[model samples]
Target: MCGITAIYCENEELTPSLLYYSLFSLQHRGQESAGISVFKNGTIKTKKGLGLVSEVIKNSDLKNFESKCGIGHIRYSTSGSSSLENAQPFVVKSKVGTVAVAHNGNLVNHLRLRKALEAEGSIFVADSDSEIIAHIFSKSLSRKDVIGSLEVLTNLLIGSYSLVILVNDTVVAYRDPLGFRPLCLGEIENGYVVASESCAIDALEGKFLCDVKPGEAVVIKNGEMEKFKVAESKEEASCVFEYIYFARPDSIIDGISVYDARKNMGEELARESPVEADVVSAIPDSGVTAAIGFSMASKLPYTECLIKNRYVGRTFIMPKQELREVSVRLKVNPIHKNIEGKRIVLVDDSIVRGTTSKKIVDMIKKAGAKEVHMRIASPPIISPCYFGIDMKSREELIAANHSVSEIAKILGVDSLSYLSLDGLLKALKRCGRNKSYCLGCLTAKYPLSWSEDEK
Candidate 1:
């Protein structure tokens, strides 16, 4: 997945630095690339590179862009190769004017749409699905205005997307009909803001307004905001993984607190699979909230038994499996004093390939833990995710090929238990998020129809 942010300020000049800091808050969403595009003096200026937000957008670069409105993006490539050209807020010159686009989520019909555009003699610059949006917007401008163009584009698209488009001074944001990704609106001092999460809005000291409804398009211009219905879906399939793993714990997505949902997941896990242990310890960051709940429910003391290396990025998101395997130790280390001689209940979000989980359990054992009981807050991920996440093949998923008992033996844990699908739903309901969710990875049942070749 990716993080996207847009801002429209009426009373003061837009600070690119503020956009930079906002992207910093969303750094967890993506680390491969960072970019920002500003509408200044009737032209859209953009700067982007393949690196972390701070590495790509320096303090000196911020001074180069000045405007009353702009959009920013942090990308983790799921649709395209990791290259500078694929980095977003992709800016292009259109017949209407200069239009820059930033997008989160994937399009299942990207190849089909791209082929159709190419047959019409459209030359593509970037390989990303995001560029398809810019091309569609540019082509639609020949017949319709910005809003109407978005409507036509949204209708033709078949997949998950939360998009922010900048046309001159107007900023348009829209979520796909399925609402597979989160995008919300916020009220800034003299204008408005739209971002993939409310945390980005809070980073800019903006007041969160509400989530942009599924199939809804919002336009912010000249300090005024307007909302439009672009398309409709019979049922919304918001990604549950956002709360389980992706989003920042501090962020509230689609009216649910991410931190609370995670905690509830841990509590439900304890209720469903109670474990006897001296201490409940998280696998760090993602698992911390759940571990707290697990500790409270099981009446086990919670401790920071695993110390994470602040310098390490997420090992699972690393591009190569070998790199992921080698980097596990660099990412976390067991606190010998806390974990030694203790029967540890190791709570983690989910195990994808089992490589990292195996290494972590081994590390804790070597640290003198009597026995390691692995507890996953979510159900086993047995299928690939095509919407936006990087899990693209079932062969790469350990759960798809192995049983729970086999997995536990493989990891060398005393026992392993994953939260049941029903348990996960109960936790989400506890957080008042009873809406339909995309559990395709857990059940191999997708919300949208797709060709066998796509999988």
Candidate 2:
């Protein structure tokens, strides 16, 4: 998944800086590329490149991008090559006007749609599925009916998407009908903002308004906001992974705190699988919150047995297996004083390929730990994600192919257990009859169906 933010403010100069800081807050959502598109001097000017937000769009770069309306994006390559061409907040010239689009979530029907568009003589500049939206909206444009154009755009596409588009002086943010990704709205002084998560709004010192509803389009123009229904409402299937891993813990999604959800998951995990160990420790970063919950529930002394390198980016989002392995080595180190001569219970978010977990277990063992009992806060990921997550195939997932016992053996742990599907759902507070979240990765069932070609 990627991060997208859009702003419309009365104070024109503040827009660029606000967008920059918003992108910086949501940088964890994506690492491959960053960009911003601003409406300046009666034209939309865009600057984008292949790098982190700080690397590509510096605060100094905002000096010349003074505008009242702008959109920004940080990208991870779920559907495109990691290159400069695919960097977003893509600025396109359309017959109706100039539009810039920044999108989060994968479009399942992109291949067929792209081929069809090509047959009609649409030349695509970038291979990313996000670009497809810009092309479709550009073609569907009617200067007097922006919402009508969006309705047409939504009807043709199938799959998850949370989009922020800057069309002329107006900014529009829309979430897909099924809402497989998160998008929220916030308010600033005489202005409004929309982002992939509320934390981006908090970064700009704005108060979160609410989540952008599924099948809803929020339009901001002339410092006023209007809401419209652009598609038929369906069952809300927000991505469960957002609470488990992707989102920053401080952010609240769909009226639930991400931190609380993770902590609850840890509590559930401890209840489901308790191991006798001297101390409880986390894998670092993502695992820390859940580990705390596990500690609170199990009454085990929580200790910082592993210290993470602040400079290293998350290894899971690294594009290549070799890169991920190398980053895992460089990311965290075991504390000898905490790990030595003690049985350690390692709490982690999830084990996808088992490569990082195995290395971490090995590291603790080498640090003189008596034993390592692993506990995962979420259920086993047995299916690949089609709605923007990086996992592409079952073969890439260890749990998809191996039993829990086999996985524990492969990781060289004393024992291992994952939170049951029921436990996970309960922790997320979706334990009732309705399935409000997507568990496509944990269970092999998805919210949407696709042809073999879409896969």
Candidate 3:
């Protein structure tokens, strides 16, 4: 997906730095590009480019800007090619005023909608699905009814979207009816903030208020807040993968603590597949919490067998397969003392293409592990995610084509086990999430449908 942040502050000078740090907290959500759009002196000024938040926006740049309302975005393309043209916080002129939009989640109907908009002579600058929302919302603003425009905007599209739109100085935060992505509102000094996750709000030292409800829009203006039901709520399908992989452990999403959910997943996995091992180790960062829970439940000694390099970005999101392969080696290293002569139980979030998993297993074995029994916290990802996740093709997914035993052999592991779908739901239930979360990647059953043209 992507990271989006919006701030409406009485202290205009604080907006830039607040947005900058908020985006930095969410840098894991996206790494391709970073951007910000600020409303100042009756106009919107946008600065965006291809890079990390720190690489694109500097302290000097933040100090030079001043605004009462602003929005920022960090992006990694699931729908469009990675380039400056596809970067977000996309600004456009609307009938209401100057509008800037930042979106997280994919629109399954984007291609068809784009073709229709083109037939009616709407020009397009980028292939990003997010740009589609900008065009539709800009046209709907002609109705002069903000809520009514949001109603119209929601009805015409399908799939997931968590949006932060800046119409002049007003910031509107909207979550799609299915709630396939995460968005939350927080209270900052003399103003309010909306972001992709609560961690961003925490980074700004803001008090988190609540999640932006499914099918609801929260509008902030002049330091006050207003709420509206722009669309009818459907069966909630909040992305389950967020807890398993994407979100920071400290963040709470939809009342469920991400760390607790992952730990519970590890516990469930331990019950489902108890393994004989000398020590338990994690893939690092994302997998650490689960590995801890696995250790607790299985009564295995927890050890740091693999050490991650902080400098390397996530290998799964690397732009090319070749780059991903090379980065897997640079991303983590085996601690020979811990791994040598040990029967290692390796825990990780999920295996997408199986390349990185295979590489890691090989490295652990080469470091003298007697056996590497791989355990995945989530169920095998046998289907593609249409909402916002990067895995778009079933062909690219290893579990889609191979059985568990085959995959274990391919990865050079002694054995392999994935958390069952039932086990996943049960773990989430313990986190107060119930059964409403989306399991499309694991079950091949999606909340929405897509056309062949869009696919």
Candidate 4:
């Protein structure tokens, strides 16, 4: 749901602009809003807003900042209403200095937790799940412990999270016990880095340190590092969607190659749903990987039938169905030549809402594709995700509302096939998890023992 970074430098060379540049490396991870907090003099000053990283800061925007230890965030807005106040790193001024927190992932029991804290006179500024965490850190002074306060907060919360807390001068990184999210450690020439993904590390000439383990909290102080491991929460169920579609193709999560895993998903899709097609084509960007796998498996030459316009911002508000009509064409345009009069096998990661798929099918047909067979590498996305990635209601999902064949006809595809529950499980096994992978979204069987595990 968000990308976060924190670094402690040995020199004043770590400027706000530089931090923004480094955080920009993970910009693709989130695009709704961006911001940063700097620990300067004895206070943490922050600049955050509802825009992309470049839109949020300019060369002169940070002219007022003077900090060495800082935290930066790019949010996709899974937890809160989209507003300036919801942007992070959330800062609170306390008697013991300032505590600023930037967090990734969603809290499952956020509403309940917020109500409980509010009953205790805890005032919240934003509708985000992250505000509670900031409040907890603010009160860490009363408990006379930072880690203990975090532990108390973690216990009271549920769902995925990877948090970076900048307490005056120190950077503390922690992940939820279920390992439902990813946070990694990186080392720069002058300092250490902690981010939601490793690509951010490579962007700054930082050496790749291993991932921040599940249920672990790592604190970086001066030139030393300390770690504390909390008990695991239920089971490890890192969101399979991260590997399937969300994380960058170049990144690695839990030792699985994002690109490789996706390719396997596509290959498995081909094996499970063999179709006769003259050309194999992908939707673009992430879909390109799966298309290659499908091409390899089918022995059909892969063609670039569709090209995506990268400039479009993430998540468009379709005020009317008429405007939504052009979203697919605005996002992707068909290369009529390759698709003309050919049997095309279309590959995409998943179909949440059918609008895009329906548009894509129409585009292909309009481009003169003889037959368009749609294949999704992952199973149909039925339920809404509570732990991040942004699906507000199960009702919004096409799969949840319509049957597979019904969806295929609605989309106007010659045929449609979604990776089966077993196919998805096999693909996960092929991803080769050091720990078990979560297929809850596919099977409706959460790895957690929680009551919500029931559909």
For each of the candidates, the C-alpha root-mean-square deviation to the true structure, in angstroms, is: 1.1, 1.5, 0.9, 2.4
Per-residue CA lDDT of model 2 for 1-455, tens digit only, reads: 89999998889889888989999999999999999999998899999998888999877788889999999999988998988899998877888789999999998999999999999988988999999899888788854378987887778888899999988999999999998899999999779889999998888889999899889999998887999888876589899999999999999888888999899999999999998999999999999999999999999999999999988888889888998999998999988999999998899998889899999999999999999999999999999999998999999999999999999999999999999988988998832233488889988888888887889
Model 2, runs deviating above 4 Å: 430-435
List model 3 lDDT by residue over 1-455, tens digit each: 89999998899889999999999999999999999999988978898999899999988888666898999999978898999999989998987789999999999998889999999888889989999899889888997577777888788988899999999989999999989999999999999999999999999889999999999999988888998888887489999999999988989999999999999999999999999999999998888999998999999999999999998988877777898888998999989999999999999989999999888899999999999999999999999998888999999999999999999999999989999999988998998656497889999988787777777
| Model 1: per-residue Cα lDDT over 1-455, one tens digit each | 99998888774445586678778988999889999999887799999998899899888887778777889999988898888889999887888789999999998889988999999988888898889988988789878998789888877787889999899878899999889999999887777888899998999899999999999999988777999988878988999999999999999998999999999999999999997789999999899999999988899999998899988888877767787877897999888999889999999999999998898899999999999999999999999999999898999999999999999999999999999999999999988766999999999999998777655
Instruction: Report lDDT per candidate.
Output: 0.90, 0.91, 0.91, 0.81
> How close is every model to the real structure, measured as TM-score?
0.98, 0.98, 0.99, 0.94
Q: Highest TM-score among the candidates is held by which one?
A: 3
Model 1 misses residue 287 by how many Å? Answer: 0.6
Please report, as a residue range, the 10-residue window in candidate 4 with the lowest summed lDDT: 313-322
TM-score of 3: 0.99
Distance from true position, residue 84, model 3, in Å?
Answer: 0.3
Cα misplacement distance, residue 172 of candidate 3 (Å) = 0.6
Instruction: Give the clashing pairs for model 2.
Output: none
Each model's backbone clash number: 0, 0, 0, 0
> What is the lDDT for 298 in model 4?
85
* Cα deviation of 152, candidate 4, in Å: 0.8
Task: State, as a TM-score between 0 and 1, how close model 1 is to the true structure.
Answer: 0.98
